[model samples]
Target: MAENTCVRCGAIPPSHDVVSVASADGSFRLLCSRCFNTEMADLAEVHAFEHPEFTPVRLSDADGVVHEFHFRSLLFGDQLSLEAFEPVPGDDDYAGFRFQVLGDPRSDPFELLGNLVQKMKRALAVKHLVEDAGHLVVAETTVRGRIEWDGNERDRLPCVVI
Candidate 1:
């Protein structure tokens, strides 16, 4: 089957029927449906916080899953609140608020990313994790941390990040 690349992470679709949505503004150019939802929602959240006149609303897919979450801008020093509605089986309804003054972007990519993806999955009770490109990893019920650090074999490895 001819492969189609996901615009978000550049990973090819696993199946022919995988749905994808792309934006025309040259921002989110190419994204599979799943990734597109994630990215769009993130952008909406940022925009709502930045622009007060625009009231943000929830966005969902055909199945009515809460795919997008957004909130209106809050005043400085005012408390922000978040509340999630019904969550899917493998998903959780998350609610929280954060306030931070605009600052310069961090230079370290990993620093901006924070802890490794594996650690986050565990915290979220997620069982499946697709690493850079197409490396899929499943976590067992029991936590058995394994770090594959082969210092000498650099040439044979796939560059996970560009």
Candidate 2:
């Protein structure tokens, strides 16, 4: 594959970006953020949780099961809420299975991220992980969760990013 395009889409995104998805697969792939949020008739899908957002995280088990999770720093208040969702059959838009995690306001962000990544690494352990040009971690990582959306975005990863 070329050094500057998406593995899934086969085209490079414009200056408007998609996050450079990183994974333990040990190779790097450039990810097109726009591809995740393909041009939709609805703009509501664009913001993860309003701008300057908490990272919308994508997690999957090694078997490729994954889910979309969102964190609100609770407006940086005393608590944070993490929400997870699952996909409905034949529909990319999910019906809410609503999994929510509340955090201790004092926990460090990097620490939380590290914990999450380590768990992901373990979930994907020895299965697969790749970091290339167009996508982030294409890990066979335990993407045990599955998320759903409108499916309007054509280039979505096997798992949701955020």
Candidate 3:
């Protein structure tokens, strides 16, 4: 009877489940479910960009001309940036575009992507009537630069007024 330690977070009595992952050398490393799932999700995100199931998302412009954008990486943060390969008409080289999702950092990145895919599907079903609506929009105050998730307004005060 010995307590197992999670190699990733070093949690003795793990927050929840513990899983064993085999290394290349055939040794196993124990990790709590949170750490293991986070690692798996990160891998999945990488795979989605590297080997996307859907390629060349087609959306029509106001002029009804279709534009294709190849799937690219999703940069995660308070404001998520989705990069794609967009080929411009009359342009020989393929260009890149970044569609941003501002605010709502509380939402999981994967969940946001899922919601976007759902919206895209709905828009496509409607024959692309939605104009210039490729980006995900969240209702929150847009702030410039990096957002400090840990800090509060009190931390920014020079002095407390009486």
Candidate 4:
């Protein structure tokens, strides 16, 4: 058995928090949690020309009604593009929403989405309509909400937006 070292810092990470990243050539690099966070932060500044696989997210209201949305792609700046199929019957097209990632760029995008979903869950718990340009809303919410994107959902997390 051999110990893995952080590819960026060349230091050993704690057993619980090792992060692995795959390079363009298909080689893998291990990083300490700190180095991984740093790399994610740097990613925020650049456009992701190559899209990564994203999982769909499920959000529930206080009444136990669930809505599913899939991550489509990343746009310029800190915005993530998403699409939600109409949970209702006979609705063919997908509804779109632009989620603006706020706060520190050092946070993982998935983690940020999880956090947002948690916020929305809380709002739904209180019987509040979770609507906003930066948050989740239907096309009728505003002109911006009408934008659509094509893709499938890759990951699921519990989240809510305040």
Candidate 5:
């Protein structure tokens, strides 16, 4: 069989021994272990705000009304900025944003952290969110700045708001 190549970076495929197959829907991807690790590492770095080292902080829309939400996850792709999703008030609906959030004082730090990471990943796959005309077209860190966190560090379990 012929060797495969990376669809994203155009790197030569690795030997079968060091690669893993990731499939989505009807498509299959052959990725070397290194490339796979690299991809994951990049994601981790982009969403590191959810890590234990980062604490969860919240902000309100100037009125000081506390917005209760879980920062589910984040996803980075061909877009220039990072868009985020958070649970809506008194409902399951979620909202996406292009800016970063500081840690929330009233919310549980660990829970918020976990949710933020998960939400980010989920947002990346949301067709409507990704295809929105307001979404950034060129990839750049400035488009979606890194979130700032400040709180007592603690472990937390991951959860998807949706």
Candidate 6:
């Protein structure tokens, strides 16, 4: 429909889980959680979760490819990052990330981070990367200066696909 609108369902209704997913044509669109998951269902894993900092978010899709999100500091430091690893063939090797954030440094080390909003958006970008293989592309190279990687298939698969 229009720019900044969901391609499948026009105009995002009021909600906080609106996500921007990549279109096959190599662009991005804003989709509500339902629509977003539907659009990406064939390509990756999509789920709702909160950052260790307690910010809520959801994401990924299933395709014959893989997607991952990378976050670089908007300011700089031992910035928090994310990843969804591959399932070891014929093994119960699952996929996941090392998600954590700090607010007061005394917040039990897990509180609403200093930049909650931006970091939440960045973590959301890490959602729904398909557990597949292929060439690597920066799905969202940067989120408010944080980088999101649709990162999968960076290296050759250890086993055959089919």
lDDT of 6 by residue, 1-162 (tens): 444465667865432334666777999768755465444433333233223323223333322233332221110122222222233345332323323343322133232443543454455455233234685333444422223343355953353111
Candidate topping TM-score: 4
Worst lDDT 10-window in candidate 2:
39-48
User: Can you tell me which runs of candidate 4 are displaced by over 4 Å?
Assistant: 1-50, 78-89, 92-107, 128-162
RMSD of each: 19.4, 16.3, 16.7, 13.4, 17.9, 17.8
Clashing pairs in 3: none
Compared with the true structure, the alpha-carbon lDDT of candidate 2 equals 0.45
TM-score (C-alpha) between model 2 and the true structure: 0.27
TM-score of each: 0.22, 0.27, 0.29, 0.36, 0.25, 0.25
Q: How many clashes (backbone N, Cα, C below 3 Å) per candidate?
A: 1, 38, 0, 16, 21, 17
Candidate scoring better on lDDT of 2 and 5:
2
Candidate with better lDDT, 5 vs 6: 5
What ranking emerges by lDDT with the best candidate at the front?
4, 2, 3, 5, 6, 1
lDDT (tens digit, per residue) of candidate 4 on 1-162:
236687788887444345577888999988765565556546766433333335566777667877665443233235443222223345323332224334333346566566666655554465434558778545333322233323334544433322
Misplaced by over 4 Å in model 6 are 1-4, 44-162
| Top lDDT hit | 4
Model 5, range 93-141, lDDT digits (tens) per residue?
A: 3332332334433345455455555654454433331224876343433
lDDT measured at residue 130 in model 4 versus the true structure, 0 to 100: 52
lDDT of 3 at 116: 57
Report the lDDT of model 6 for residue 32: 56
